[model samples]
Target: MQPVVHIGAGAPGARIRWGPSPRAFGSGLALFALLAVGCSEPVPPTVTEPKPPGLESEPRWLTFKCVKPGCDETLDVTIRQVGARKLAIKRVVLSEPDRTEYSIESELSAPAIVNEQFKVSVRYRPIGGPVKGDVKLLVTYTDASPEEGEGRIPPGEVSVPLLRRLVGEPVLVASPARLVFGAVSPGESRSLPLTVSNAGSGNSSLVISAVDSDEPTIGAQALPALGLAPGSSTEVQMGYAPQAAAYSEARLLVRSAGDMVAPVEVLAVGTSLPDPTVAALPAEGLDFGRVEKGTQKRASIEVVNRGGAPLELESVRVVGNANLAATLPNEATSLTLAPLESVEVMVWLSSETSGDIDAYVELTTNDPSARLFSVPVVGMVTAPHAVAPGSIDFGKVPKGWVLTRPITVQNEGWGELEVKGLTLVLGSSDLFTLRSLPSLPLSLERHQKLGLEVEFRAEAMGPFQATLSVETNDPGGRFLEVPIRATGSTCAEGCPLENAVPSCVGNECSIASCESGWFDTDGEPENGCECSEIGNDPGSSCQEAHYLGEFPDDGTSQTFRGILPWKNDVDTVTFFAKDAFNWGADRYDVRISLASADPSIRLCVYWHETGNHLSECYLENENCPESRSFQRTGTGGGDDADYVVKIYREPGAAPTCKPYTLSVSNG
Candidate 1:
């Protein structure tokens, strides 16, 4: 008998009865008979249902619509796994009829496992009109291996419907596919009319959406989004503005609401003229080679017009170095140049002196691109010469004292200028002498300068005037006379350092002897002697300000130096002009600079008569490393004018003295 057990009972413990058997009867009955025996129920065999094919897709249909312009139509289909079995997507393709307009955008050549998802992109083109088909996916999968019968499943085709709408099929036609605007000036414009018509169904709405030109210079536009019924038409005007001289080609893109058909393209052409272009034959410059002094040379420049329109020549003149002259034909004063027309203008060079002839042939024309043209003309006028200053002044000299001054003599002509001799022609020859005359036959090249020195020894106190002549190879003349004037003085007994008194010096504008080892270098007596030595008290108040006197000449600038003595100390330098009316409304620039390790020094300028502050500058603290500069560029005054520059230190600055410079320059 088989063993009996409580089966199918959901309980932890149960009673079981065992039937006597041959093997059980023979077991050590004596020792095992006393053990307790129990019986339990057995569990039945579990059965599982087979999984169906696993391929699935979300939204199993794909639809494409070609409505928007300049863009393709596409849709996505998702293939997902649904069951507890492995599957593979082998290949995906579109139906035969849809292959012309649709194609799969994803590759499915490799095997895909279970629970995997795939997104397939379907692209559709509207060129093949409206179409409908199915997206067929070929899938290869496996059956359950653990359960009975497991093998490679057969490949099956899963179809998903694909719908496409070639949104609108409006027949858009643009008449005369090309346009030409014959010729237009740079600033002129021309316009032409274009017609767009739709010969489709009345239910369709056609938008004359866009009209664009390839060239920005060519302007075009159409009635946008023009709603038209079948057999209807509208006109668009296109304009062209030629900004430069060129043959411009452009294209017009006429688009409809949909990419229903290819865009109607219109070819456009325009021409803008640079009427006349002046081309010089040499293309660079005209050289009259070598010309002789007091003679003439001739050359010509051909003016050619390589353009589509007439070039009008207004005038031709000579500019630059005046040694050369340019002459145009009488007919060229005012002439027109037809397309590819050319003319020749005669240019002449005549020189009265010896030098290089550098001039330009300036031609004026009506061409838009080029209005004025300059052709260089160069030639060498052979001669040799020297130039001397008009006059020289020894100023004032002391009695029985010898003095000397020098003037520059420049070679103003080409080649070598031969110096023959220098002689005293007039005045007291006994008092004047040539320190060292130029060596005989001294050759001076072009642009070379030499200094000629003259000496004067005064034997008595009186006024003296003399003329010294310079002999050179210049053809203009053989002798160039330079005048010299001076006065001699002797220091009187008890001579004091006063403007009217005798402050004896070797020569005027030289350092003069003053009491206390003081010397005057600027020839100004209004300051009681202005000195450049350190620690000299030039006065620091408006009343005791140093008088700088008048500027020596128009557009002359003077620079002077002074010192700041103590904190809160203001140093004043006053300037006066003798002929302020000569400058008219012209402005002057007055700059004052103060240099110091301490940055708190300030410079201020004011009108002496009015005491009005003009400008001031100063550094804030010691951290700043720059110095302060005060400037005034505009001032008005009477004939006898007075202006003052003041230098002061800020309140918190150190009391140490510092040196500063004041400069007055032309504005």
Candidate 2:
């Protein structure tokens, strides 16, 4: 049995945003003071109430200055009323005819003052210090009260400061805090749309600026020197041109005119895209030689990072709706791989079932070439009770017509696939001639298949069971056979020719033959027999077992281990190593061989939950002198998640109690 592994997949904590946005805080405060504010009382009115018991207040001011030069000026202003009944000001003269506008608003539920030149005093309710909103005022004089006048206080305008952090076209969200681009190509220039949002509740224009450290190679540019307001964001592609030098790595920085001192960084890395880029994994159509269904084959591919920087592979995944799984061993888990370094991940794309199906592997490394890499698969398993349909039903043909069918051979076993030569059995020696197609190359990929065409022709009428003898490089090939049927026909006038081989050349006939073998026949011996419930009989029952334990070491890292595929052995499996250092398991290769009581059947071992193939142990396929070579693999840095292993049986194969051995050493 293969090891079963499970991991945590979600974050463990949560919190809410309660911090006010800096841009929003500043802008909102200004808006609050401006719309509901009034100028100081006129003629220096004397204050009379120095002891209002229970009323507490503090002073704050609102300011709005366009930080541009040459527009420097003050404004004439006075309190139309001493106290707020709706605070109002008159004589609002513009410092520059172009700079002043009459704008004022009142606090919530506040009344309006109706005086002209700013009255001296009036009893007014002290608006709670928290008063806020935009106000309206009319220009009493086109000229702003001269800023040159001594002791002169210039009236200022107040409104929300439009955020100018970062953004294009849309000034609202001028900059982005995070930017992500996946799988970019060489010399590809992508315009990355960016936006800086005022995450606050106030109105602020967004301002954005881009700074490129790797100029030209990886740089930034923007329209509208200024930014945007809150809630608005612009879309722009980040233009990227990877130089031959950039064939390695690249970076871009964008700066915002905000509190952020360091600019946000954008990175570009090179990739080893497949020769022919594919959005998904493709089937290479391989030959698994010839094994059985319910078996597994193991293979590996390199995950090389061709760029200069480190690669963060969130996972090395297998993506088919099927439960087949693949993974990067712990050493490769969430690896931060340096440039040019490759990590080998284990892949299992075939199931323990049968069919001409496909398994997709989703390699989750952000390699610029191919972010998501897929290894194509072709071979699947054939039914346990059935052989590949390699026969041609070319019904009765005109004496010399030939029909053909191509059949694929697949090896889905955990062991070697043996393709013994084909034997031409005379299912119809007198009526038909059967010949194998030209010697065809038949090297199948693991779980992969190879197709062969068989031609059939008839010369006379007869019953046929084209016996196809499959000679295999596989040791147990003699036990398995393929059968092809080629029924032939010859018809003559009303001779009432029935089983003499008939095609639709004449009328159809419904005939039934009855034969009883319990009694002796006058001139025939029974070739086929049928029996009905002769006596009480029972069918075989199956059972499930679980194994979870530690691995044992025998030799150095060069040693091996063994266990049985049945009950007692199924509960425990162990492998040996050269040394005791857990980390050094990387130096050893672990091979586990499967042996069964039935030499005609094979045992299959794979990861239970993920269906990941670990190894294939043949029943009697391997016998050197007196033993078999156990398949080895390292559960390096093996732990609870990586150390356990499992073994099961292929369909049509009987369960055995023979012990399977595991060989360990470094490859």
Best by TM-score: 1
lDDT of each: 0.63, 0.40
Candidate 1 stretches greater than 4 Å from native: 1-277, 287-293, 304-344, 352-400, 408-450, 458-467, 483-667
lDDT of 2 by residue, 1-667 (tens): 2232221221111233455565676677667666656753333333556431111111111233322222232322333222222222333322332322222322311122333323211111211111122332322211123335543333322112111112222222334444433334565655566544434333334355555556455445554443444444454445555544434335656555565434556554433332222232113522334335556776665555555556767766655436256678754557666654556666664556545555556666565676776665445554322135454454443333355656655665433454646556654343334344436434443466555666666555554555555554443343345566665554332123122222324332212232321211111111111222212111121112222222334433332233222222233232222323454345334444544354533333322211222233212222222233344444544321122233333444433434333333333
Predicted structure 1: clash tally = 3
lDDT of 1: 0.63
Worst 10 residues of 2 by lDDT: 52-61
Model 2: how far residue 394 lies from native, Å: 94
Q: Which 10 consecutive residues of model 1 have the lowest summed lDDT? A: 616-625
> lDDT at 632 for candidate 2?
45
**Model 1 over residues 538-595: C-alpha lDDT tens digits?**
6676566676666522566777776554445667666754334444464444444555
Per-candidate TM-score against the hidden true structure: 0.31, 0.23
